[model samples]
Target: MSGSAQVRAWQPGLDGVVEVLHAYFPSHAYPSHTHDAWTILLVDEGVVRYDLDHREHGLTRAQVSLLPPNVPHDGRSVRPEGFRKRVLYLEPDRLGADLIGAAVDQPELLDPVLRRRIEQLHGVLADGREPLEAESRLTLIEQRLRQHLRRQVVRPAAHRDAGVAGRLREVLDAHLPGGITLDEASKLVHADPAYLVRAFSREYGIPPHRYLTGRRVDLARRQLLAGRPAAEVATLAGFYDQSHLTRHFRRMLGVTPSRFARS
Candidate 1:
């Protein structure tokens, strides 16, 4: 441990959120371990190096790291000045299962806007005077994160067969509220993942992941219109939570789920 190292942990008044950590270290190195909840961290100063899924990542003030549940990882300071970080530990189910792949695949995000919003959220949590305000801000933060992770495939090859894409769509529709990975979908259709993505995009005008998300949004719309609570609609439509549902719903329909329900 470094001479200047310090760590603090506390809980916030929010469901599915486990705890928050604020820490500083000069030379301390954390041994590999796993967390039961998702570990989202904001690096406030200096630099930190970590390994997730056998890949190394360096996080700085402009970056955020999102580690999924039960994933083994290790960390240490990357500079002589050490590092300061704020971490939020949330239940694994706080985000949709469909989003986990991206989180695991790319744990660190270099977005200045997201970094600033997270800093503001930390301030609100530390003040402890505006629980609802903090919750709302957190919702937006998660939404931006999901949007960033959602990769868009542009201008797919036109030479692939359209029939295979149609069959894949049918399989996806049959498994609504449940998701199939690109690898799984490829195996089902006897095509490579790259080909499947391009072919799907060419035939449907959207990638498979986006297409499935749209279907879920459609289901959420019907449930909201039938008087179901937004939170319940989120679950029934395969969304991770109400915030997850709201993010996609607003993006697709130009209105939030609550507003859509009322209209």
Candidate 2:
């Protein structure tokens, strides 16, 4: 395996995806191990050999691998050059208990749609400014995975929950700078977390998280124009810090917050 300098890991802002990893292994083998979260793995170069539930498997660029939680597994490069990979360690409950069996039976998936989606997800995760997009992509990915596991069509969410969507939006508005978690939002609105996301998206034409971000940006703009410093406006406007506000501000308005205020 490569040195620690060659590997990077972090916890992202999204609740569904707990950790992100990018690593290269030059010549290392992993011992059997278990994780409390599901591992969504993609290999960018070389081949990886792995063991899950005492069965052998291989991962390559042509596939996306989903390893279920609490399952014993090990992995290593089959070639001397080893493998370079990106991984998202998702929360265990995101996939649920029923799908674990299907994963054990078929951990290696050869779906081009899934591979592309995972690649896109990793891109946004790296940017670290698109939590809303990340959550939406993850929702669809889970849908496809459940379809694979159940071997049946998982219907897309209906647009019949306008009332629920409207109420949830109000609740989100109430939560503000200290935004509510997905679980809390669902509980307050009396809906499933996934259903809440789907309903809000269908009714508003944007994800809940995006709506919140827009609101925060709006607040920042108002405060900035009032002559508040960028650093101070950051927290007052619900952003984590100045850089966080600057990233979203530049992305949404095509200029940095300071420049926007000058304009």
Question: What TM-score, over all chains together, does every model reach?
Answer: 0.56, 0.57
The stretch of ten residues in a row with the least summed lDDT in candidate 2 is 1-10
The RMSD (Cα, Å) of candidate 1 is 14.4
**Deviation in angstroms for 259 in model 1?**
47
User: Which TM-score value belongs to model 2?
Assistant: 0.57
Candidate 1 residue-wise lDDT at 229: 89
TM-score between candidate 1 and the true structure: 0.56
Badly placed stretches (over 4 Å) of model 2 are 1-5, 152-263
Assess the local accuracy of residue 86 in candidate 1 as a C-alpha lDDT between 0 and 100.
Answer: 90
| Candidate 1 lDDT by residue in tens digits, 124-169 | 9889899888988889888887787676222333465778887887
- lDDT top scorer: 2
lDDT for each residue of candidate 2 in 147-247, tens digit (9 for 90 to 100)? 88787333443446878888887887788777889999888888999999998776655678877776687567667766789999999988999999998
